[model samples]
Target chain A: MLGTWSDGPTKSAIVDFVGRVTTEGPNYVVPEERVAVFDNDGTLWCEKPIYIQLDFIVRRLAEKAAADGSLADQQPYKAAVAGDLQWFGGAITKHYQGNDTDLKVLAGGIMSLHASMTVDDHAALVGKFYAEANHPTLGRPYLNCTYTPMVELLRYLETNGFTCYIVSGGGRDFMRPVTSQIYGIPPERVVGTAQNLKFEGADGHGELLIQPALDVFDDGPEKPVRIWSRIGRRPILSAGNSNGDDEMLHYSGKPGAAAMRLVVLHDDGEREFDYTAGAERILDHADQFGWTVVSMKNDWTTVFGD
Target chain B: MLGTWSDGPTKSAIVDFVGRVTTEGPNYVVPEERVAVFDNDGTLWCEKPIYIQLDFIVRRLAEKAAADGSLADQQPYKAAVAGDLQWFGGAITKHYQGNDTDLKVLAGGIMSLHASMTVDDHAALVGKFYAEANHPTLGRPYLNCTYTPMVELLRYLETNGFTCYIVSGGGRDFMRPVTSQIYGIPPERVVGTAQNLKFEGADGHGELLIQPALDVFDDGPEKPVRIWSRIGRRPILSAGNSNGDDEMLHYSGKPGAAAMRLVVLHDDGEREFDYTAGAERILDHADQFGWTVVSMKNDWTTVFGD
Candidate 1:
């Protein structure tokens, strides 16, 4: 049997709309061209004081700096290890300046750092990191901080024949390596920020070059543009937790027969990180634009994996 | 019910291995990793003296040149319209060389080439070209020249839960426009040669920048290497019709609990083009490989769509 919606006015309204557009029940509809896109970071998971991936990158950078004398002298590298995250955050881009050295050196360094390890080993490292890490403000296990209601929304759309894709500003490949297992969305269906890679043969085996420098950051407006180019179609439904996904929701809400754009409002202080203002990532846009505002506080009975 | 394979020395060996590895009656069923990779042109469909995509490019060039005088003076552009198949063919790479035109330009050019036309229009144009154009030697409709048995083989593997991907030397996006409908595979799952694409836009709605050059060509050893990079794992089953796919087959055949590589041998004369002895693509590495050879002459059945 299909699962019931954990009751509430906001949840009921959103679920009812999704149900109408899905390929079954009363509405039993949607054009064959219908598509849906979702943002990954705060909308899909938890991004409070800082994005989880940025933390991973900082950690990776710290390890590299400790091992490599040359890297230790670098601005972001040195700062990352010293726990000076402010300097390490997006500051590496300024340091790289005009040359391709940052990307080349960083990606190469990162690959060499973990290239020899098998898939199992990589998973274990990630698992250990997640277990020990804590969000600065929330002071909770990072892994247990995902937005549960948004996940169910994703499932509802998919069940209705919507081709759901994760379009985020985070690393595309990194998200792909684990999203399918975690969210039931396959790697091919996920698109996000990417590092350039090249093909080569190493030690009598084929390998790909994973560059460290940023390629495309699927943030804000870039979200919708990348969606059109990569997906070749506009999505009929879109959901996001912040301003990073604004363009995506706008694109999805483009003039069409039927469309839906939802902004997940973090109103639940007890269950999840509650924020009233967040630099226009989510709250500001919700009031300005007439989009479905899902109140995490009132709409969800659960916020993370139980 | 499982389909029957003719009793043969080689066939028996392959079937026995699969039988032992499957769920119903299995010894060691390696679950969730049954990846299969395929070579699109010549293997999945038909590629004779020239590729189908080349014709599309040439036609598009002709149309573009007709509209823009700048293109007419171009070496490749001039050669294309004059019906100088040889000169035009030789300039295939040159057309894409250093042409850092943005996605909008590339997409606009592509969409405009056959603008406002229905799917049938596109299909008919392709069919008309295939019907009239003559291969360098085969002298039959390109579509009529496909390997019949191979199509069955493709579906056969898919039925067994093998996720088949088209890993070919052809343009990845070019094939994506049509292959899924024709071959029953989705666009996201297909991987092939690519031109560099740039993302642009406040919301990522920028045009796809097709560099006037090839970004990556999925051919020769690059086939298997690209497959691993894109898919992040080696295929358990592989099929190819030429030396271009030899690396892929070899990679698939590498010792695992159960692995299989099948090579399609174009040996039929009366039913289709039979020129294996001098076939430049598949013959080069035929002697060194230990793959299951599906002989067109000996293999049961038809050769093309009736």
Candidate 2:
């Protein structure tokens, strides 16, 4: 599965580790709890400059603002409608601080705008956005920005009976609609940030509807903690690309029976957009912790799904 | 595991279905997509006059009310504090809705409740809660109220490579904490209703803390809808007790596969709580649609953990 690591350091280490854990080895074993976790955004797919979900939300907010005209001048949203990326960045943090009248009002606006469509409709919207929307620096479809080595690693873990789960800071509802076809991981297994939803009955006939409210952000160290809280089992293997995934890697590396953690470092720019400029904090920790930091340029023969 | 199904119509039908699904006979095989799901409360456990989690929440609420001097004149809190079982039924639905506010407040109040404690400390809390709290009707530890026949059915499905998951309307986080110990099912395999939780940095370090919030109720049809949205993989076997699990059973019996949906009718008031007083809506579809309805009184040698 590790095509780049077929004869190199990255491939050999993983191969050796797998061999020792299986029945043929000296300490041969198959622990009933063989769980693996992955960070979705940058680790699995393209998450640089902006997350895929954030891009979707921004586009959604702008579309709503354009059509309604009522929220036309609502700070960041107004900037979003005017196609101003700088103002959009400044307004997002303010919006998250409960700055709006009701978080649900803002969330419901997005949910209602998007919820009427089926999964296929939503997928088409996302697919269209990805094809046309360039990654500021990568200058390509967001889907084309995925790390090939990490995808190979995901498949490798699955071959070993490890139940891999995506624990991201992205929206659970948003990802649930598309993750299965894209990642080969089903919608149910994708755990991420989620907004609170309400189910209201229509005329007592028990019809279901989605109501949105600001709920939780599953990011940073929260990744691993939420992993344990939601999944109960600690992952024996973990992979991540940013500070958001640091805790997950640490959690996987905690002194245990069979644990391994790999941190993906974006050092390749020719094949994929490299993040050597802004993600210094993440790069520093990867070196400090003695964890394997995978160099994109040196590690893979491809990027994205071919 | 239809141990007591010697001659009764309910028992014979259950046995016949299990035989068909597992054996190599003419009626043996089932389509892969004919998935099954089971509800935990009342269907598997004794959620009579009150649900198990509600019992914990109410007791905690009364303790807080008593401490704050609010229970001195309040009807539900005072009755709860005084351990009046008869008054509990009148307050069940009211307590279910209003309890969320108190639960959110209480959950928000517990700053480092879990972080400070060791694993043993947490297990002790569960043990203490189980020991001190008595079911309103059963007069035994709430854990002891679990139905044994259902447990056997769960084991039987696992042996047949029919992947099973606990799809309930209870809090996913709360049920996850002890489900592995009690049900032999890990947290990832258990799906349930949940209060929204935000993750925060723990102890100013890289560690994280999960905090609860006010949110949606995942009962009735929402149970199955969430199951399909979250797990993606549907079950070929399904079971439940109340109207909450009706959709899940419906999902199982769809035309795609030779599926079986079973409903457990709690008919033994002496051994278990009876549903005759109309505690929950028992649908007519179970019989009309050819589902195996197991009468609790005639199906098992025991009711709870032996």
Instruction: Give me the displacement of residue A202 in model 1, in angstroms.
Output: 8.2
lDDT of 2 by residue, A12-113 (tens): 767776666665654444555567788887678876556676677778888888788888877446656776665443333334343544333445555556
Q: How many residue pairs clash in each candidate?
A: 21, 11
The best candidate by TM-score is 1
Q: Interface Cα RMSD for candidate 2?
A: 5.8
Tens digit of per-residue lDDT, candidate 1, span B6-105: 4565456556656665665434455446677888876777664456776676677787798888878755566657766665433432333423333233
lDDT of model 2 at position B124: 52
Measured over the true interface residues after superposition, the C-alpha RMSD of each candidate is 5.1, 5.8
Ignoring the other chain, what TM-score does chain B have in each prediction? Answer: 0.73, 0.77
Docking class of 1: acceptable
Candidate 2 docks at the CAPRI level of acceptable
The DockQ scores of all candidates, in the order shown, are 0.24, 0.24
Question: For candidate 2, what is the total of clashing residue pairs?
Answer: 11
Best by lDDT: 2
